[model samples]
Target: MNGVELVCPAGSLPALRAAVDNGADAVYLGFRDGTNARNFPGLNFDQRGAREGIRYAHERGAKVLLALNTYPQPQTWSRWTRAVDQAAELGVDALILADAGLMRYAARTHPGLRLHLSVQGSATSAEAIAFYREQFGIQRVVLPRVLSAQQVRRVVAQTDVEVEVFAFGSLCVMVEGRCYLSSYVTGESPNTCGACSPARAVQWSEGAAGREVRLNGVLIDVFGAHEPAGYPVLCKGRFRVEGRLGYAMEEPTSLSVLDILPELLEMGVSAIKVEGRQRSPAYVAQVTRVLRQALDACHADPAGFAPREEWVAALQRVAEGHTHTLGALERQWQ
Candidate 1:
């Protein structure tokens, strides 16, 4: 419970400020390029914006984590290295990286700079984390959203590397660093291009069949007359399966670990991440506030901790599909 940072997402300068102002202990953000994931239109930070954000976050005693989470092509490898240099120059508190080469470059070039393993690194076990920690001096690792609470606890028990788990925002059923549905349809995926279902390929149309969305001309979902549309990703798309239209891969939902705050604290979890950089600043502010409140309550009295109704309601307001899950973090039956 002590020194457990609330790591919130900041896709833009506005979101960064909102997260910091809302009691976030740290904020993770990406550059406006392929070097980091969550590269979307009108999103991410430019050099100037990153410097300002660093200042804003530092002034409030909050750390700023620069994400260099995407893999690199041989021809475009310098882009990732340059981002690492710029992050160090701009005074980022740490670098969240997935690529081994990038992590090595950062560790070698700026030995004092802290390194964190991004969830995209796919380090599910302590052995994998130990490799990064021993090779590149990664001080922390963001666990992918695939581990049950028991599994995560086991990993933590085996590794000294700080653990950061996603506590809120969208669900990725495919697991981080490996999902290829976007590339299968759009030729670009978060792994290299830093965007899934890249905005350029997303098509929305109104027709007699209520509404429909497509990615790269492939039909993804057809909405009902009164149904709400979610993110234009194929994973959550409702499709005709066995003669009935339903979600086959995964449903549209967000992950919330409100019910397991005490368990996380008990496991010596170093951080809890909020996973929305594509969302608005309002979303960041609201989620950060609710999580901040919940963390404070849990830390105050872990044995007596219980998520407040209002806090849960506040999180649902910004949750995908207007609902939330404990995600892989819950496995009481197991």
Candidate 2:
């Protein structure tokens, strides 16, 4: 257990500023292309923006990690390699990457540059992490959201590499790097095109009874007159199972680990990541502010730490479906 670094997401320059200003120890961002997972339109950074963001973060005594975390096809592999070069040239503190080929390129070409295994790499076990560290000298690994706190501790104890876990924001129900649900509907996925539930394939319509959300003409979910609506990601939608109608995979809920800050800190996690690169600067500010307060409180008194009501309320305001869960951190949630 040590002082946990608060790593926040910065999809844009303004979001990066918001995260740093709100007390982030480090900020992670992606290039404005298919190289990063959050390659949504109007999000992420261009070359100039990435340079400016790194300068801003460094000036403020915060670190910047560039994400080249997508799986690139053979035809598009050069783009990913070029992005690694760009990140190294930009003086990023580290590069979060998932592709083995690109990882090798970065490690071999820029021996001094730090490499972090992206969650999309799906390295949950100690052996998987050790392999990456041995083969490519990966300094850190962002664990997928499917592991429990105990499982996380086991992985950490077994590896010499630093471990980073998601603390807040949207939850992906499926295992990272293997999810094909979005691809099945939109013909694109985070593993390939760098986005699941791409905006271009999403459609919303009003029907006589209620509202409807469709992804590539496939019905994702339907909302009643007064029910809340959510993004049409395939996993978060409703489905019928055994003649019962409900969310078959998972509901549209954000992950909030404020209550378990002490457990994570005690587990010796290197960093606590906030997962919202596609969010606005305002969202970044609010989330960072709350988590900053909580983490500070936990560091001051881990044994007696309690989540503040105001912090929970503030996070819930921006939570998807107006609900938050511990994700797989709590055994029951798994």
Candidate 3:
């Protein structure tokens, strides 16, 4: 196996620096608006901050990919277009985008700027990827976390474009860019507003039994006295079904593909992306460090590769609900 690019998330300037300092090959981030996903309070960069981050990453031999990965309504189209211009002006290594109109504008207006299809595009098939590559000149596609490794290998075999896959962090059970559970509850979603389970609508209440988590005043989950509490995202919460209470849609767990590093490398994946821009700088640093070490180990001896116990422990310490899953990389998840 050869060296696979390690792309880390940077929700803030500090996170950007931490990723670069911790041996990330590239750092992808979003602006402080609806143009990108992970639009959370006190996170994401502004124009000036993004420019500084690009400079910082370049100085450290790391590339920065600016994410304008959200869809835009008719009224918001100009803002997304202007964001593309601003990203090019700031010297971003590439623009990660999802909207076709925005991609067309970027490709036609600034032909030299590299384009990457965000996972939000949800292009799982070679035909869909081919259309983007031909129409908008997307150089790479970030595959959604919905395919098994064998399926991913098939996609790679069918496409000439570079492929990137999520390797770690929170898992979105719903298909990227199509989830409406948050919007149904809060009138906001990642596709339009670049957020799910918006902080404003979240509420936690302690009770005699334990705790209750709610989203937009709707009861999502109730925790036992000794059970661990999690975020009130509608999908990951436990609910009543058939007179029994349990995780109905999905559980509160993160995706960790550390064990499949060799398989990804062998499949000729161009990059492995870490997906936590809403998390803190410490989280970014620790995750990047562990992934960096794992990547190095795999590249050194692919056949002998194995996940380190310490690496797993380190990631679990920061994982949501203190649990992780193989996600769709394994057939069982499908």
Q: Assess the local accuracy of residue 39 in candidate 1 as a C-alpha lDDT between 0 and 100.
A: 89
Cα lDDT, model 3, residue 271:
94
Q: Which of candidates 1 and 2 reaches a greater lDDT?
A: 2
Q: Once superposed on the true structure, which residue ranges of model 1 sit more than 4 Å away at CA?
A: 332-334
At residue 72, give the lDDT of candidate 1: 93
Q: For model 1, what is the C-alpha lDDT against the true structure?
A: 0.91
Whole-model Cα lDDT of every candidate shown, in order: 0.91, 0.93, 0.92
Q: What are the per-residue Cα lDDT tens digits for candidate 2 across 235-258?
A: 989889999989999998999999
Q: Candidate 2: where are CA atoms >4 Å away?
A: none
Displacement of the residue 205 alpha carbon in candidate 1, Å:
2.4
Q: Per-candidate RMSD vs. true structure?
A: 1.5, 1.2, 1.3
**Could you tell me which residue pairs clash in candidate 2?**
none
Clashes of each: 0, 0, 0
Task: List, residue by residue over 1-334, the lDDT tens digit for candidate 3.
Answer: 1478999999999999999999999999999999998889889999889888999999999999999989999987899999999999999999999989889999999999999999999999899999999998889999988888898999999999999999999998977977778899999999989999998998999877679888989988888887877778888888899998888888888999998889999998999999999989999999999999999999999999999999999999999878899899899976
Task: After superposing candidate 3 on the true structure, give the runs of residues whose Cα lies further than 4 Å from its correct spot.
Answer: none
Clashing pairs in 3: none
